[model samples]
Target: MSRVLVTGAASGLGEALAAAFEARGDEVLRTDVSYEGGVETGASAPSSTHGTFRLDITSDDDWAAALAHVEATWGGLDVLVNNAGVAGGGRLDVATMDEWQWITEINLFGAVRGTRTFVPMLKRQRSGRIVNTASLAGLVHPAGMASYNASKAAVVALTETTGHELAAYGVTAHVVCPSYFRTNLTSSMRGADTELAGVVSHLVESSPISAADIAAAVLEGLDRGDELIVPDQPARDAHGLKQSDRATYDLVMRAQAAKLEGAPRG
Candidate 1:
């Protein structure tokens, strides 16, 4: 069985992916900033094949420690899933500098650090996979989430570049662009203002996909060796919108915004 390490394993997609891997008899190491909480609750009922490690993705020292633990236990990692992220909800005009920095630190820089620190381990394996969780917001920018969109878009670019660089080493990279998966990521999102909060709440309510579905899609993508994994129907459509026509895509997004604003609230 393959050995895997997943970041942001406290909840949502990361937790789901870790559970899936463990269920398949793979050795899974789950990590998150929520050390006590995640260990006590996140993997409360995890399979026998799974273990937990407290990791702060933004810290190099934490990554080093986690890698050392993997070396001691699993010997080598076959998969590295950078699933940690923070959502920043706000309009471009009013977004704070601190919010922008914080979002990028976790969402973009965190992935970069994971990829960098784990590549040596993966290179030793010769045949390994790296999955970075991006989002549909990366492809089709929504009106009020500029910082989040930018960070995810950077993840897409980073994944593409890293995939090319690691190709010669027999390591593959995949970027998951999921649309509106049901998870705590939304509830924990930082809002710029009250107006942005309302807009974000509406978006979350309208999302049709779930974290479990996205996790399943990730495994399928890994099996297929897909470079970019758009997990759901909405994600597929959003990707198509990017490639079809720029003007048409903008018009469609504008229409969506209008409809969201007009829709009744409970």
Candidate 2:
């Protein structure tokens, strides 16, 4: 069975993914900053094959410590799931630099750091998988969530590049672009201004899938050696829109924004 290390496993999609892997008889090491009340109390905790640990994805020291522990305990890691992320939504013109950096740090840089530090261990194994949790926002631009959109976009690019780089080493990378899934990510979303609150709320209300479904898709993608896994219908459609016509996608998003925001006619 593969030994998997999942970051952000304390809650939400990460927690669900960890449980799913463990249920399938894979060795799972679940890590997240919130240890006491996060995944520790959820479905992830009761899984027979899962173990929990504390991990702060934004800290290099935390990453080092977690990896060391995994190496010592499991001997080596066969899969690394970079699933920790934060969400922020609002007008780009009003977004603060601090907000942008914070979102990028957890959503984009955290994945980069995890991949960088764990790639060597994976290479030592001579075969492994890296799964980065990118959002559908990465595939298509949506209004009022500029920071989250940009960070996830970066994740997609990073995953693609890393997959190419690690191919010769027998390491595979998968980027999961999931559409609105029912998770606490919406509750955790940070906003510097209240101007876009209604817009963000509307987006959250449009969620069509569950976190468990996304988690299942992630595992399936890994098994199939798929590079890009769009977990739900909305994600697939968003990706198609991106590939087919950029202008049309933008127009559609604008219309969605106007409808959600209840804006007056121009």
Tell me each candidate's TM-score: 0.90, 0.90
Q: Candidate 2 regions off by >4 Å?
A: 36-45, 48-50, 257-266
lDDT by residue for model 1 (65-139), tens:
887887877788899999999877566556789989999999999999999898998887787889999998878
Q: Which 10 successive residues of model 1 have the least lDDT summed?
A: 36-45
Candidate 2, residue 168: how far the Cα is off, in Å: 0.5
Let me know the TM-score candidate 2 reaches against the reference structure: 0.90
Model 2, 146-215: lDDT tens digits are 8889999999999999999989999988899998877888677776656566556665677777789889
lDDT of 1 at 33: 87
Error of 2 at 41 (Å): 12
Model 1 CA deviation exceeding 4 Å by range: 37-45, 255-266
RMSD of each: 3.3, 3.3
